[model samples]
Target: MTVRSTAPKDTLGEELVRFDGVVKRFRTSLGRRQTALDGFSMTIPRGSVVGLLGPNGSGKTTALKALLGLVRADAGTIRAFGRQLPEGQALVASRMGALIEGPAFTASLSGERNLRLLGELHGVGAETVAEALELVGLTQAARRPYSGYSLGMKQRLGVAGALLAAPELLVLDEPMNGLDPEAVRDMRALFTRLRDERGMTIVVSSHILAEVELVCDRVTIVRHGTVIRDGPVGELLDRGTVHTVVRVEDVTAARSVLERAGLAVTAAVGPQGPELHVGATAADPGPALLKVLAEHGLYPQELRLRQASLEDVYINAIREADAARGATGAAGDVG
Candidate 1:
């Protein structure tokens, strides 16, 4: 099918990939049909790192596979590089590279040799393979056989393979998997440099929310085969509620006081012991919460407003989507 470019005209730059209302279904071993993608849509802007995040079995891999034409969607369209997919896949194949799930290689071959073989197929040479290995910090382990490498090393090798072609659009699924803390940090920096120095558009799907928040410019959170939330990371986090965290000698008493004052409260055991989180509806709820607690003869050791973290935003988004869906179903039943 011919897919037209529906990207908005802008100085920012045209979107490199667009999956519009895509739908994919599969038959399970139990003879039941399961929907893998339900009207899923996403736009990948040029020179940006977009994080695709979702829970397990939430269609994250399915969507990425569909984008790479590894699987066909029963409906909807996928356009990339101003060209229709599958039909134009060959034309744009050289410009795109991907590492899905993991990389496969001859176990007996050295890491460097595996990359070299992969590069050779794409007309890439030894120099490109070496550079890719170095970029992923795999230079020291390059001569080691694939079977001898650790899990983290294997992950780095996979990343090296994806970069072998110097692709303009790189798609990585769980790129941070099997990486240590230091390797994770290095990978984050590498992704940033690829976007800044190489001007590449990277689409990364990962369960590592904090890393995604740190490295990605934008994020799209999906659930049940559809997008629940999609926007710039900063914008989405900034729009979240600023919660008031209270650490007091009497946790139960503080919670009672806050709840009685018509404030929403949740109690949990933090690093500092029992803590109460009060939803801050006003610009500053600290003073009000403090005053109310004082009246009850309870003193707070600390009360602070905490900005929402990416994890908080993700949880809230999933909850909001579930609530909205429930409401829709309820309305449908009434009608």
Candidate 2:
């Protein structure tokens, strides 16, 4: 499939958040200027699940903090729910539930009490707090002291606090940071429910690519404070040409047969069995490859097509960036 230069704008339909060439910077203790974000621009559509992914110090948090008005952008514009941020920050933030670096609560207080206090601060009632607890599957742990709660429980409480106000947007930074496998699965299900049932637009930021793959409808990958890839999860994964994997009893013979058939064999490896990666021009290469293998009496155990994963794409983008930087350095030295 041919790759498009630009992503279709109407994919999500309505805009809930937008950043126009936003730049943020700070001064270090020694007085050197540090730029955290430079000309960052993005638009998050309403009611869509978006994954914000980056390595540590990639400005993912900076982008979120700027949108929330916790940090001001040195240049450009930011808007949330169609209003300029911080100016309408109170109004916009009131409609947003966020746990940027985990939620804070009194360790001595019970889960219910902590949420009760948070609800009162948000001008919500006790019933809202109880419902939020139930929504995050914390009802059974509601009476437990915050000090005794597990890391997962604390994360759930953070989510509960976000839900207390029935906000339109949910921005969670590493919500699954310390969660166990079961807790991660539960959180995934809860996010799905919140999106499909309640129609809440959720933005989840995490360094875990697989979890993001499972939870997000679309993903934006950032590296060194820049977005390298942004598009639908399916389309992004479907980028580049197609390839097939063949698992056969005789790896060597299979390679010979495929090569003779004019198929480009990209990779071949195996310990328990032999495997060959063949570049394909068509979707189904099974019939042609199978016939070639059969001619040599090489019956294959398995044959499947493989696509580049988000992790693979992300690594490639970073490698390209590194190469570009190196090239620039070399040119400067020559000059």
Most accurate candidate by TM-score: 1
Q: Residue 239's C-alpha lDDT in candidate 2?
A: 86
In the range 1-335, model 1's lDDT, one tens digit per residue, is 01123223352345889999988888877776788888899998887899999877778898888888898888999998889977898898878889998888899999999998998797878888888888999989899899999888898899888887778889998989999999999999999988876677899998888999999999999877888889999999998778999999989888888888899998877897889888998888888888899999998999999998899899888888778768776211100
lDDT of each: 0.85, 0.79
Steric overlap count per candidate = 0, 0
User: Top lDDT: which candidate number?
Assistant: 1
| Candidate 2 per-residue C-alpha lDDT over 258-329 given as tens digits, one digit per residue, 9 for 90 to 100 | 898898985556464558888876878888888889988998898888787777677767777558758766
Model 2, position 135, has a per-residue lDDT of 75
